[model samples]
Target: MSETTNVMNSEVVKRLLCYVSYDTQSKDESSEVPSTQKQFDLAKVLKKELEEIGASDVRLSDHCYVYAKIPSNLDKKVPAIGFIAHMDTSPALSGKDIKPQIIQNYDGGVIKLGESGFSMGPNEFPALAELKGKSLITTDGTTLLGADDKAGVAEIMTMAAFFLAHPEVKHGDICIAFTPDEEVGNGVEYFDVPGFGADFAYTVDGGSVGEIEYENFNAANLRVEVQGYGIHPGSAKGKMKNAIRMAMEFEQMLTVFDNPEYTDGYEGFHHLGGIEGDSDHTTMHYIVRDHDAGKLNQKLAEIDKASEYLNFKYGEGSFKVVRTGSYQNMKEMILPHMHLVEYAKEAMRELGLNAKSVPIRGGTDGARLSFMGLPCPNLCTGGANYHGRFEYACIEQMELCVEILKKIVEKYAVKEI
Candidate 1:
């Protein structure tokens, strides 16, 4: 057996199982740094684990960010590298009381989730076919499996444990951080970039084993409000304008082909995520995304154009649009530092894995951190079908990710600063 395969088969998997048990789902409507206090529960567990593993300077911030470092044992100074992952799971579904089910030696066939009446097969998820004979961790269908990022957390923790256990292994300074509220997009709001003190960083928050991401969507949120004149039906005439009807009209103005269901692979879309309110007033929430900044601006302009036309028809101030910039594509920041990408690919290749550079259709904390001057890219965590109950993580693949991280660390150790 290989040395990588012999390093505690149960360690990474045990850590992952412990992490998903915490209810760390972030809230979007809450106006707080973490957006939810439950994130601190997991943060505290990670902080103690880091200290137990002999990581130096382990600190849990007041805002629920956990930071630590593994000091270099080398005589020469090398570039300090950081690995980051988020603590909070997506609020799209309930994350409370996640009961993860372990399937040993998957048969490359249909598998049923515990009592939740949900089942997955190789036909529906082709990725499962490739993972045959490997142990898989999945949810019970009552709640979402927190593998979206918990798999990442476990991998990093296991890597830290490995390096600390083997004193003979030489490497440079290794920085680690676990941020909160990434699911709600406020992940790096108060992140201490200078304090974390890494020359460059990577977020281990991507799906699949060999995926590497540097490009992401230029994203923005749009809020559309429509004010209508309301009156009793008996007394109502042409003066009574239905706000809900007008809101539907505004939605119809958007191109049908530009919706998420129809677009893929560099295609941009305007997704109407939520809508609320009744006759007198109506509000529609949309997230607009495009890899191209110019195209993103054009989509925003479409919203403005629609609002202007509605206001012209219904009188001034009757229709309004609020656009909020979220995060931009990290491609520009990473292009100047191609070594980060090349080194990651080399590490994966060294592990006999095919490295695939896939653009993130959504965003990660790395997307915002790159613009914040860290030039962060993203790495895979061996999980798939994120943000839903169908999520699962492969044990063997996650262990390989740990090996990949260790190889990258070795590469940077020899690299000239």
Candidate 2:
């Protein structure tokens, strides 16, 4: 199971460790856009790192969003491209004080996360077996590895630094943006596109190296509140409207086939991600997703009808429902601007890396940016099992990822001293 790519620079490991040492976990329940203050800590450091690498006008906004410009060294006018990565990690696990363990020579065996029983192994995650001779950075079972987007951040930083230091390599204007609230779907809420001034962009926030994506689920969030009538059990007869029972009935109205557990790969599903409350009142949170816009609306219609039907059955005002637009599929928006997609794939191929272009089962900042007229797609970071304790990344894969990213930019733009 030894499949290591030793072509990457060893210095990348050093930069990655420093980036992950900061705690940048997002809090979904928070009212703020960033959701966590620690996110800015990392954002500020990245801003400094970019400036230190010769990025001009490196600035951190009031909301902790970081932006910087790398002017083109070439005199010819060309397309300006942007590279983006989110600053916050998922709220799924603790990201504080991450202890990243470096396995210089992976043996394809089980990796102990911590304690006794729970460990990351090939038997559990066969993907680890693919990194036999490669270097691996993993968490110690207690905290999640921030490599999900941080690796993407560091990779972009590494590439940008390379371009700045080697001005002899021609390229166009390169823009870097680090957004917040990505974990909660509000990352690009306040993003200024005209200010960014880039023809096309890519979010370097995907799994596995060489991964490129131009599609994502058309998503919306559903909030259902079941309000049951209260009455003493002893005195209740036909008047007792239990919200819990009604909520169950409402759920039963939808097709179980339209669920996440029953779907995979381009197939969308309705996921009941949150639920709470008892007896007198309750709330249920659902996520409706579909690649097809028509079908996406159909799912929302189904939810509306389901709620209306329950209301009709249990009398008026039996329940309430709200659906918020989360993110959209960028494929349709990207059709007119197809060159960006080809440019990225070609960039990877030119770097001797096979680009795996696919659709995202979930949402990304790129999804939102596309609707905002940016038409952004997602690129890989060479990490895997994101947002969990067992998460790990191939150091060598990220190094190559940085190289491919630079080449992608070089294809469309030039920066020469």
Count of clashing residue pairs in every prediction: 0, 6
Off by over 4 Å in 2: 1-9, 414-417
Query: What do the candidate models score in CA lDDT, each in turn?
Result: 0.91, 0.84
Cα lDDT tens digits for candidate 1, 1-89: 11233333578888998999999999987789889998999999999999998999999999999999999999998889999999999
lDDT (10s digit) by residue, model 2, range 346-403: 8888877777788898888888888898989899888999999989989879888888
TM-score of each: 0.97, 0.94
